[model samples]
Target: MQKGSFIGIDFGTTNTSVVRVFNDEHGYKTVNLGEGGDYPFSSIVAIPRQNGGSLKFGRDIKNHREELSSDYEIFTSMKSFLGTNKEFKVGDHRYSATEITTLFLKYIKDYISRTHPDVDLSKAGLSFPVDFSPEARRELRTAAENAGIKVNSFLSESTAAYFANRKAGQAFSKVMVLDWGGGTFDISILELKKNSITETAVFGERVGGDDIDFALAKRVHAEIIKKSEVYNPVAFEDMNLASKDYLISWCEKAKIEISNTEDDYESAIYNYGMYGTKSITVSVNLFNGVVEPIIKSRIRKAVDAALGRANLKPASIDAIVIVGGSSNLASYEEAITNIFKDSQVILPDKPQWSTAEGAALMQIIGGNFKLNNSLGLYLSDGSIFPILKEGEHGVGSVIETLSFSLTEDTQDAHFNFANEDGVMFERATIPTKGYLNEIIRLSARIDDDQIARIQLYNNSMGDLQHSKPTNVEVNKLTFYYDISGLK
Candidate 1:
């Protein structure tokens, strides 16, 4: 935990996991925090500030809810909303998403400091969703830094999952990673030739286990209505209602337990409400029928979309790796087999812990390797405007933003993908032409490849660049900017 500690912090949508790398005489090894010793910390954050009490972290908030003040507040799914650059309200006061996120991360930092007092996490790789925009990427790093955690380069969650799978005797030159976690779902296509791994294409949705839990809760609520005549709908309708939401938390737990042993029919799932008078009972068959179809549909579409982007078919894929907590469902496993019949489907040793583990390993293995090419914008007059400059940047790199409008009727909008030395390799034609003054957005991305690919609909935008250990240059790098749509 000294020089190049190479730790990974997967600040996930629902749960946060950490992994520290170790090396000595026997080469390199990884220790996933949750699976190795103590349990992984939950991303669920609680504060009694709304109730005039002190802040609580991790197990204190989760296990001792009954002891909390009556007007206490807890927040989950912060990762999902962070991308929107919005603020969340707890009680009557509103706080920016970044502020609350920093608060949560500070707790994580304290946890690591207490547990591994000697370890320093200044070079840890931070994992974020593949579809995160440039602003979202910056936001995540800023929050982590504010929390007293030093973040070294970023890793796409799915790519990190790939490294974790490959380390465990997986022998696929080409693999697809199905990263379905608590609040996000990403399908990434990676091609590994020899030792180098590259993320060729990726697709993701802003939905995951948290969404599934809400879906199942809706189904359970309906069942409760049908069974008990004395049930009241008032509790479920209020957004300020914490007890009902707490009941939904119980439903989330039941979803996980049943997902692990889905074949069992002897046990029933139930979340009792208000002195155990009214409750909802769910069966395994119900679980599969209600939520499995949703998982199957989204996952199938994501996998197909990713493969299609890479210009490959299911047969071309050697193996499909499934990771994250939600992916452990027997139904999802069955769905993978049904869709990718030719490809070998691989499950992780600890499905939920792979991202953090692989990220830690990746920090040591592929330190500054670029995943994709840098993007440049070229005008019809043969002038090149480097949108995303082709070079690795500093830790506090400021990603530039450029916007262009279709001032006149134009036919050609060429995009050049190039390397660091003004060498262009690939060109893309954004053949968009219409009325004058039509503004096109350039929401820069450093994460997910596409939500809608090749439809003239850019879900997000990004570039890939490598870094070096030496700090010759600070965050004062300049870009060849042409913010206007003119030549």
Candidate 2:
């Protein structure tokens, strides 16, 4: 482990992974850091319901599954809430998602400390979905720093996975990467150059493996309750959230088991809180019936959207690569195959490790930064001119030369930042300082902390509430952001 080199981290929704790259005169290689030499540790945290309970993670939390109904609180799917800036409350404590992420990262740091005593991880190459905004990135950086690791670079997960699969002398020119994880599904269209892979476009949605688990669990729970003569279906619906979570976890395990086998899979939950002795018989066809629609619809929209933005058709795609833990579903491959009949779809052997490895490979190859959203100024004619294009700038760099001048002498001149849909994220009034067509230089950037900071630069007026711009060097207003989130 080099002192200054970046430690690749896939801080995932369902599981987290860590890797350190060793690069020298020979070349670059990776050393995995996980229990049993595998690249995954459960990404969950458990807190006791009592006022003074210690935080526990990984297997320790799983050991307390039976106590979930009354004794503890479990936090999962926090990664899905990134950039939403929401908070969770228990007793008098309210923890923002960013703070929880920082704690989880700190736990990861401690694990690395214990498992590989010789290695010291400081700087990291953390992977985020392309949809995470500049604000989300900043929040992640803050969390990373709090966890004792400085985020040297933020690589989009799908793009990193693409690089992980790109081989020397490969014939493919264009590839689409699908990352269907527990809490989110991200898709990226990439252009493979003579020697490197470049991400052309990426799109994401909130649907993932967790949704399937919940849906299946609900069905299985209903079946269990129906077997109980005393508890009616309506009454069973009133079961506590903890019971729901427990059932969902059991269903998720069954889902994973079914993905590997070629036949029907059966799982049973014995002696639940209210329902005693209930079992589920899930065949590939049955499981597919529940999840296929979501997989098909989302994959279609994401793949089509990416391909459309990249100006390529289905036939033009050279390969479709699947990455992430939940991508092992047979339906995922089937749906993709149905879409691109002529193209080949690939599922890498170590899908879980691809993104983290790609982050390292991306760093070693000097990859560029890809902004997940578009920042632009809206024109008077309902049109927009873009600034800080995604995939164009280097990571953590600022866009300083994007200056705009007023074309009209109206009082409602607005500067906004948003996605391709033109919905405004945050807006500001251009303080002309009492001049017509004043040059207002706007330097907007996603700082190293992943916070989106837009500085309105002008020699004009200042910061007067109702008065013409007076004398403030910078305004104090910024949008709420940490990682990017999509509707």
| The best candidate in terms of TM-score | 2
Candidate 2, TM-score vs. the true structure? Answer: 0.84
Candidate number of the best lDDT: 2
Query: TM-score for model 1?
Result: 0.75
Query: How many clashes show up per model?
Result: 4, 14
Which stretches of model 2 miss by more than 4 angstroms? 1-5, 235-237, 366-393, 396-403, 416-437, 446-453, 457-463, 466-487
* Lowest-sum lDDT 10-residue window in model 2: 478-487
The sequence of per-residue lDDT tens digits that candidate 1 reaches over residues 282-377 is 688887876767866776777777777677988888888899868877778888888778988888777777888766765564344432434445
TM-score of each: 0.75, 0.84
How large is the C-alpha RMSD of every model relative to the true structure? 10.0, 5.9
